[model samples]
Target chain A: MNTDPTRLSAAELAHAIASKELSSVEVVQAHLDRIAAVDADVHAFLHVDGAGALDAARAVDERRASGEDLHVLAGVPIAVKDVMATKGLPTTCGSKILEGWIPPYDATLVSRLKAAGMPILGKTNMDEFAMGSSTEHSAYGPTHNPWDLTRIPGGSGGGSSAVVAAYEAPLAIGTDTGGSIRQPASVTGTVGVKPTYGGVSRYGLVALASSLDQAGPCTRTVLDAALLHSVIGGHDPMDSTSINAPVPSVVEAARRADVKGLKVGVIKELGGEGYQAGVRARFDESVTLLQEAGAEVVEVSCPSFDYALAAYYLILPSEASSNLAKFDAMRYGLRVLPEGIEDPSAEQVMAATRDAGFGDEVKRRIILGTYALSSGYYDAYYGQAQKVRRLIANDFSTAFEQVDVLVSPTAPTTAFKLGDKLDDPMSMYLQDVATIPANLAGVPGMSLPSGLADEDGLPTGIQILAPATQDERLYNVGAALEKMLVDRWGGPLLAKAPQLTAKGA
Target chain B: MPPEHARGRFVVREAPRLAPMSALSRDDVAHLAGLARIDLSDAELDRMVGELGVILESVAKVQEVAADEIEPMSHPLPLTNVTRPDEVRPSLGAEAALAAAPEKEQQRFSVPRILDED
Candidate 1:
């Protein structure tokens, strides 16, 4: 195996597998090798299904050899977040409670990815219960940003983005409860999209805040992202809330690369405060490039954005606290008996199970959630937050009235060093401030790398937000910016990544 | 850790302790933890008290708007009947499901004895 592995892109990988130029086995082996060599240092994958992935890849190769028709994603390797349940693949949600528990069934999205013939690359690390913006809260160790090990990769989808950026996989799936996908993509210099809330089914995805959670595609290129989005974005009878609207042709939009006559709204809030200088410079330059490409840019303001973080905290934890209630010792997950209490009472057993299984951050959120949803405070807190959530949604609705789409810096800065702020949960929560509004509003948002952070010299991104059903606008604009940036930068961001000492590639 | 003096309407309202804040004093958090069936070390409880206080304060901004007339919006998107039909669907059979359980007696998953005599 070459120390500097030059693997195929999504299209190339798919074509090679289909045409028999590259057997699925070889493609799967390359990635498994990549994981073995460097993933120890990157810590991107929570679990690597070496044998299972190869066996599945081999099945794809055999089918193609038998002259069977190929699925668009046949033989592709996609990493799943640990938050998404996969049959028998320790879906721990980065917490010790679910550490050794292997879910008996696959999540809805997992089944979709599997049916598409994508080899499950294994579960990637994420924030415990998708609660934190950085994966540091993972009961497992944090995933280091591929750009610089010292910096974080962004979370809770940081591990997913890192695998793609590090070339351990060509495409991955991430859940964007509140910018989990987009924020990490910004820092890691990859493509991440949070489809309209109903665009992707959430049946199997471990819930953080159901209203805010939606799984989207993360890939190295816009076309690739669009392709994966099309496959995973659709209605499901299982999830009645899934939109019945037809999934628009995002791949065609990427292929068209036509930005003419599109009105892109520049959200005034996300531009300056806490934005790194390089990020702003790049964002401005990209806007100019889009303007030059025949797209009109307009300044749009959403004042409710200032309060989005507050609303998100209340809603997410309240929802999470409830959603996670199923993991009692009575159901699945850890069940412990107290140390000294012989034949402990049920209450003691419950306390022991919880004390041993739950982590600090998880406990903290549950407490906060219980308090928010508690009776006397319900109207003042939970009820009020829901009202504010509506106001935030109203802000988006109003903004979309004047413009086709909205744009802003995806994150304040590029990926920070792992452990830089792990001890500080408040600082960690603040990282998702820029990306959470869309989740509250149920809007579709995509993040594509704009420029390197001048301060840290790592990738940062700008987010594209479009109206609920009008997700096509994101593709129209994202593809345009992606094409422009790649042409200037010479290639994808991961192309410049140096070989790692551990995972050679 | 959060500032003790940082207590505000936002903090108190958003993450109010269990009980009326009167039912349990320093033990509200502990009792809440117990109710939720999650164990909390002294350090974790201490941290949560301070964190919850500050968060509740920050979340106070939600009340600034006049919501007396506003209806609670459960979802951002408009909703009608979002629930699926209660139609019969194929489910796993006993053999398929019990085949993988860590420990199973008969058809049901047999976990360790969880309850003590009430």
Candidate 2:
């Protein structure tokens, strides 16, 4: 009961909850209070089910009282990004189109989390249908950066990043489509991982560029991600693309983290042009740290990384438009016809539904996707984009041949004000520069907290990328760097995070 | 930069510029929208036509460097045969499947008839 509530790490909280130093109900209540207090300004969550969360917490408490053996993450509070469906929870994907729709089933990842005994806090916000790089595209609203209330948190996982950064929750799950998780983590100074493409089951995740989407853990510490990721990742029969493989040994990799003798390739093209000086400085510093840790640092150029964004825009939007077609008002989603009309034409209802349901960014992509898929343009646009996708994958494979892993500043800059880049979607899309390649190549990528942006003093992140299916490499390198950085900084990156005590911490 | 990199996908070559279809006019955007079955107003079409051009221009960078000698990689990982074998398994039948349809009669979903579609 006396566990210091606000600042505890997920690992610490899990131990406390299991040892009875804290009650699951108390843990959920504290997070709920935090969300209630700080989230109004941060807008991290589109919907917070305080009552539902409390009920789940009480269930965990009862199980423990009955002397039931529990899972490792038992009673720990977790937030699900709105992009994933949770049974009975409003899984809106941060869109007004499906505002009050409750899902009938949980995503496979969510089911795994609940099975692990983690308490579901609520659904956090995300870009509308996970289409935007910034959460600004979310029809409900953009999530504010927790470090600075006025700045934008990265997206479409921005809401999840903000919730963990703001201490509204110690851990949350997020999906990454072209850097959604890592980019947000860069801006929020949290740990975000996008596992290998088929690492986690996508059965219940709202489809957003299915080929590019993969869900992973976002937390304040590397070990925390390892813990959560282990529980949710593995082969699933429900997803045809799910890898029929054992979960990578992330937890052990974290514990045995050592960068000595490893080769780290600094992608020559990632940092030089279009990146902020502050971000580059921190990236250079990270490379130096890696070298000092006995790892050989070298520059490996993945020129294909330069064209990745162009390839992604073509591929992702094309996929998004097709996927989102399921949300037609004729479906189980919103149906808004004329003010008063029975048996309105399905065409009119669908037109009205998409117009109201989708935001400008989403609509823009859908149109572009439609154009690309059009018979007249498909061979040139979609065909070329798919070819370029192959080129990018080749570039990653070639680069890994020279280096054990690649590193870069997770994003070009730190957190920006919410509205800063919204006006120009191109600039917003460019923000995923460091993150897109891994997703494009179907490999693994993770962002570890680095130093703060000199200008805004908000946290920045450094990314570590690995070859496909070698997700354990990311944890091995990431955990080593995180532990070293924490030791140098005298604690975890969030140690200096502004403490916002709930009504009664 | 390395040549013929491992797990190679698209190849990038320097082009004086990435070229997109200049064929798209304002009317083209409107026509494309209709074909896609999404409704867009004139004002929306006006903006979309221009935005689509730039997006096309930006993404056309892919076309600049890829050589005809290179084969495109559709997926990053070299994975194949991601299918489950057919087996007798329980499934939610037609009643449960169409349970949420807005209009239903005699175990069938009723909707305003449209041309063949999903």
Candidate 3:
């Protein structure tokens, strides 16, 4: 057996623990040690709950020793994005407003993870309120890309992807509103999936854009994501938007790993012009590989996709404005008194506290949202964006009629320098262009490492989009492509990544 | 009442026309920040004016095709009101509910004065 547990996938770790060849405590401790060794440089985690994780691992070991059946992913340690509410663990959403605040209850998904006996490593960092493209927006500071220390590991789920890429955790949970999961996964050379909207319960996920937010698995391999997804994806009456139907058989589809006779569409609008040369080359190579693997490939055009980024900005800020209004000084977060006021009013306190607590990006969006949803502008901005939303959904429906799944480069380019786009919001918004269309249309999308770019030698991801409720197709196609790509590279793409040396060594 | 298909749907009677968009001014941004209950500093306000102007100009493109007879999608899935039996169930107690409150008094969240003294 491999002595280093961090190098193993979550599936491998689970098998080792279940067979009694390794104890859950040992596996969890190994990851904790790995975190201690590399995380100072990586900065992937906002908090590391080492004691709680070890206790949970012990419980799993005891249950297994008593000959009790366990979930497939039981005993595996995982990191969670800070946006999910985990009781007793501080969840900051990478913003100072909620700093030091511990959630009173676990999110439904977190509760599910517990029920399945998975030990949570801790909360990972993200962009403030999941707002920016680079993790640089995190109030705690940015997570460096493990591939290249100076570059970003895409946002806002940068921490989740970085942990997996750096081998700090086998699996992690990430929320995607507009490419938060996939974009980071693309840049970090990992696998990320955004389950069909309503597929995963949103019950304790701090709302970003409610309509677009969906929590899913981030892992190093497609099958590992599948295993984690099945545990967390299901109907939750607590979330009204949760689908009443059973989860798609993603695990089964991933194991099948068959793409024969499947129809794959290369979205016409998602590539060209703004895309990097290496990204396009890698995407084209993946398409050819899919065709050779017995999947029929065709070019499908969705013209409304050109407006996806525009509509997303309007729709997100509008929804976010309403959702974030609850962060007034009175409850559950920071409070500040107006300067030079003897008896400040509630409104004044709220204004001052919000100004002090929120970072610039969060403030920017809230004000933008307030402006969009305001009278006179609502009809032109928010309403118009909602209409464009329908057009994008229609485009998906039209494209789905021609093919089983849509494919594209997950991001326009590989991860840029950490502070390169920090001051420019528009350029940062462009990172999510390809991934946003899936969220708008209520579809499931997966991003898997296609290959390292020829120019920068950084990872590039090929996105696979399946129509709503047909999320299994994404796994089937994704696993097949992942296998072919890995065989060509002679190993996982992460293996090609430069290794990180211990901080003090 | 309109038919099921027409309900909650917006119909544009006129041909789709682009809405005129003017760049957001500093005063406009300041007003927006006020509406949002965030007291932006003068420097922040100055920077936001230029940033918001660029973002607003880009997002305004949505108005181009929006004049068509398209129903606005507020949510991805068609969700009806989800309800359960009107029965008592275990929920968070007051102790736990107020656990995260910035300030609390007598098991209730404390807030700054909402009304002026008479």
Which regions of candidate 3 deviate over 4 angstroms? B1-23
Number of backbone collisions per candidate, in order? 14, 13, 0
lDDT digits (tens) for residues B57-85 of candidate 2 = 77776666655666766665565766667
Candidate with better lDDT, 1 vs 2: 2
Q: Give the TM-score of candidate 2.
A: 0.93
TM per candidate: 0.92, 0.93, 0.97
lDDT of each: 0.82, 0.83, 0.92
Better of 1 and 3 by DockQ: 3
Give per-residue CA lDDT, model 1, range A367-397, as digits (tens): 8788888888788778988887877788888
Residue A49 CA displacement from its true place in model 3, Å: 0.2
A1-505 in candidate 2: lDDT tens per residue? 3355756888888888889988989989988878877877888888788887788889998999999999888888899999888877888888877787777677899999889888888899898888776788888878888777778888889999989999899999999989999999998889999999999999999998989899999999889999999999999989888888899999999888899999999988898888888898888888888889999999988867777888888888889889988877664666666446556567766776777677888888888888778786675677777877777787788889989999989999888787888767788888997899888889999998988767767788899999878888899899888877888889777767666544422
- Give me the runs in candidate 1 sitting further than 4 Å from their true place: A1-6, A502-505, B1-25, B82-87, B95-106, B109-118
Ranking by TM-score: 3, 2, 1
Query: How well does model 2 score by local distance difference test?
Result: 0.83
- Where is model 2 more than 4 Å wrong at Cα? A338-344, A499-505, B1-23, B82-110, B113-118
- Chain A vs. true chain A, TM-score per model, equals 0.97, 0.96, 0.99
Candidate with best TM-score: 3
Worst 10 residues of 1 chain B by lDDT: B3-12
Q: Candidate 3, chain A: TM-score?
A: 0.99
lDDT string, candidate 3, A1-505, tens digits: 5679999999899889888888999999999999999999999999999999999999999999999999988899999999999999999999889999999999999999999999999999899999988889999999999999999999999999999999999999999999999999999999999999999999999999999999999999999999999999999999999999999999999999988998999999998999999999999999999999999999998888888899999999988998999999787989989899989899999999999999999999999899889987788889988988998898899899999999999999999998999888999999999999999988999999999999999999999999999999999999999999999999899999998988752
